[model samples]
Target: MTIVLHGIRNCDTMKKAFAWLDGQGLDWRLHDYKKEGIDRARLEGWVAKLGWEALLNRAGTTFRKLPDAEKAGLDAGKAVALMLAQPSMIKRPVAVAGEALLVGFDPARWSATLK
Candidate 1:
């Protein structure tokens, strides 16, 4: 099975994930939402499974730099809107394999999930 890793190309976490996936000899491809962008339907599906809070990178520079009003009172819809406009605001290295969706990189978790 091929795993699709979604994130920006320059992110440190994505770099690590790429190295790890390569070490494991897995067939993986990058989604690079920063360049390609993510669609509402797919984003909504991920939110349904992973929850928007988990998918949004609130701690990231992009989110932190947002105006106060933009960060306040966020819901799934608003969060989706923000992420759609700035895909970098979404969490890094979200790995998808068939029906499985992983929000962040964890070597142990990934090994188990891929197995």
Candidate 2:
């Protein structure tokens, strides 16, 4: 099975995830969303499985830079739209391993699920 890890290359969380993956000796490819851009269909699929709230990165600078009005009214559709426009606004290191989709870098969860 192919595992695709999506995030910005420079992100510290991504770096940790990469290190973890390397240490585990797992084969995976990194998809730099900032460089390649994100696909709406794939984003929507992740949202469908993980929920928009899970995918949205409200703690990030990109999300913080948005106007107050934009942050106030966030339904799934709006959140997905925002994420599509700004891929950085999506959480770091979204890894897809076979049929399983993982968001964020949880070493414990990775060990349980990916390993």
Per residue, candidate 2 scores C-alpha lDDT tens digits across 3-114 of 7999999999999999999999999999999789999999989988989999999999999999999999898899989998999999999999989899999999999999
What lDDT does candidate 1 reach at residue 98? 95
Q: Quote the positional error of residue 48 for candidate 2 in Å.
A: 0.8
lDDT of 2: 0.93
Report the Cα lDDT for residue 99, model 2. Answer: 91
| lDDT measured at residue 101 in model 1 versus the true structure, 0 to 100 | 93
Instruction: Name the regions of candidate 1 deviating beyond 4 angstroms.
Output: none
In order, candidate lDDTs are: 0.92, 0.93
Candidate 1 structure quality by residue, lDDT tens digits, 4-88: 9999899999999999999999999999886788999999999989889999999999999999999999999999999989998
TM-score of each: 0.96, 0.97
Residue-level lDDT for 21 in candidate 2? 94
Candidate 1 weakest lDDT stretch, 10 residues:
31-40
- What pairs collide in candidate 1? none
